[model samples]
Target: MNITISLKRRCEHVTEGTDEAGSGSLLNRIYTELYITEGQSEEVNTQHEKHIRVVLTNGVAGVGKTFSVQKFTLDWAEGLENQDVSLLILFSFRELNLIKDEQYSLLMLLHVFHPTLQKVTAEQLAVCKLLFIFDGLDESRLSLDFYNREVLSDVTQKSSVNVLLTNLIKGNLLPSALVWITSRPAAANQIPPEYVDRLTEVQGFTDAQKEEYFRRRFSDEDLSSRIISHIKTSRTLHIMCQIPVFCWITATVLDHMLTTDQRGELPKTLTDLYSHFLLVQTKRKKQKYDEGHETSPQELMEADREVLLKLGRLAFEHLEKGNIMFYQEDLEQCGLDVTEASVYSGVCTEIFKRECVIFQKTVYCFVHLSIQEFLAAVYMFHCYTNKNTKVLEDFQEKDWRYSRYSSDSSLDNFLRRAMQKSLKSENGHLDLFVRFLHGLSLETNQRLLRGLLGQTDNSPEIIQRAINNLKEMNSDKISPERSINVFHCLTEINDHSVHQEIQEFLKSENKIREETL
Candidate 1:
């Protein structure tokens, strides 16, 4: 069924500048454009049915792909949107992956995941219009052998998890089922193009929507306005604000900084932004602890630093294994007591969330994939600069331009090592970490990270070396997205000369990087 819904307009400060008479109509059009059909409905016969059976919604990390799907399903379930879509079954690939090793028929799979469905007969399910929402295909570890899997028509047929999914999507099993799969752009290829009837991207918020989000997030009008102005002033930060998660992070960080009378410049780069946020959270936690006890400020700061380091280590290690969620043992492995880790709810809790898994088991994961990557970079920086004192001492005395033969204390060696580690992953898994590593070499970002690390010398030189290493790497072999990420890494350095060099390099090579840049 073709579904369309109109939303009521809510008068607000951001919309005050627009035509008041046209606001209601504009809201109607927006909702219609967001959910209305863009193509003609396909024909159906006794044996065949068609109408965009498979819809693939793609987005980058933290762009709200899963949230959009959730909202859509919830609205449908509430009879507020897409009322014709009955039986909306939502499954996250993260949870689905846990059962990839287990053998189960499609009927059993549904029974195990949704027990209520067991009461419905197969004939009833076939007749009704069902929407299956599969979220986070990027997190799936199942080997989906779509090309090789044989078609199975029976729901009671047993097969590998991938085979079941492939057959279900291919119309061999439950052909009438309408499937909506949400994934990061990188993993959209797991399902071949032939299977997808419609592809849409969740582009996060628009400029006006961003303003609305800020107003809703911060109750203080003056503070929210200041933040809006601050974000508008910085091009890089403003561009990143297009993402919903980044907007939340900005609002949270600026709220604390503005009220506390921060003296330094606001964060312009991603690393600078996250570093400031981390420092603010740690300091806030320390202050709370200091108020109750006679603990010294230094001692509190030391404890906070230790907690952050342990969390960072956990983030880095689990990220390498492609694990966003962990168990109690994982916390213990990071030298963190469960109670101590739980107390980190204020500072790092956003990064590490505790949730119940199957069988009443509890699991912890970074709130978002990018958070894990960001903390991984922070861990790498902490390891080379703070934990290892010799590296900081050598940075002060050594001529880092030349390679060191004596030890790994050389900043150049450390920078090269970081690049190597990040570049080894072809999936571009380490793209953010690589970008943040370059950003960490900037003096401004280092200043923000100072509470967790020692003072640095010749950070600009290290940044230059890292940039050179990036340039030496083959970009043509990787996706254009990675190349754009490389450009973003250059911008994170926040150096005019480096920007100019990038412009020259692009000009000489006859290449135009991302238009947004």
Candidate 2:
């Protein structure tokens, strides 16, 4: 009804950055500092008292809710008539997973409070007017820890859910009076109803806003004009901009796509847009060869290439292997560097570097979806036991019927070839080894083995090399128990298959009996 309501709606229009719309993310700061939360002038500051401003802003992810919230907090704080009393404290629920206990949550608040107030009491927080921006309800803690280990207990309120709800309703952690709870509707439903205000969902950017965005990305005025005109007339482009993030993604993608693919047509959907983006990235890499510039992200890519190719080599050896999720920390022992932040190539590396690789739970597959499929398909090909020639041919040869699989199959095939090239060490990524894999538990290492190559019985031809390596690991270096563990992981994928060869293989090797017994 008022500007605050209007402000909430306007926030949805932004795809990038602002206090309300962002978690103050440094990555790809869209910085859309435009949202007005009505003339809540009286609401926020009643008769110059500065009514505890509980600013509730909510919208879908990538809709820029955090960005708007951040902008509002800074602006409101700057505009405040009184400096000492009015303060904006920003908190994110995502970070609480590390310490989910109520006392710990209070400790976090007290700690933050102490930094500013210098031994200020928690009781004092209520007396003073404070502006708090609690963000990322959707990403809150599912569990908590004590002494740095997830102190798992059957306590419900002791659970992350209770800690958050208690703080909002009873604890009044942001008790400064004004609390803004922002979340997507689905996520908003998660928070206790008593504290949060009426639900407000941001309705993304308008057509004119998208046009302006595209104009900014494009340097050429004429090109920008023509593009906007084309987008307005085009059915797909007009439909795509219904949300802010999509608009930004579309604009960013289209800017690059139209330039390289300038000769032909424009991409319609996000999929085509991604394909074009990948292609542009591919082209950007190719520029090195033409100009002969040696160092680039390609160096990192080349090393990554080797590991993926080795993974493919291992996978083709074991396609009928059980399970798909490969835990990386377990895959690379000496345990991924145990810190709070891992160094990343970005602007905020310094702030986040100390805590890197504390990833006991962070599992990753290949970089892209297409690459994962490529590895799967490559592994499937080597599994001679899966003699469904049609399925094998479907993945490998790409005959007429196979061609009908999906357009994405080509991209999958693309990664396969890329890895295959790297495997040969002909192009891309010279370092084929994942140094971490050597340190995994014999159990996990055996599992990765199974992921690459099937059990001993239905094993594929390409996996012969890997099999030889496992045999060497078993006989020459390791103990018998570890070798048997690996053997179990591979063959267990089809312990009950129809193949008599496999049945006999399992029986003679005693693999099935080992796990079951």
TM-score of each: 0.77, 0.47
1-517, model 1: which lDDT tens digit per residue?
A: 1121211111111111112112222222222112222331232111232467888787777776755664565456446788787677777787777778888888877777765566666667778888887888877878888797488888888988888899888888899898888888667778887677877778778888788778876788998999999999887878888887788778878887788645657777788888766656566555542233333323444656777777778887877676666678888999988876343555665455665545566666676676777777777777676545553343323443322344555555566565555556666777787778777777666655655655555455666776676666636775676667767777776644556776799886665455435
Error of 1 at 344 (Å): 5.1
Structure candidate 1, residue pairs in collision:
none
- List, residue by residue over 15-109, the lDDT tens digit for candidate 2: 23212223333322445433233333222323333333333556544566766665665444445333454445556554443344434444345
Alpha-carbon lDDT of model 1? 0.67
lDDT of each: 0.67, 0.40
Lowest lDDT sum, 10 consecutive residues, model 1, at 7-16
* Superposition-based RMSD of candidate 1 using all C-alpha atoms, in angstroms: 8.8
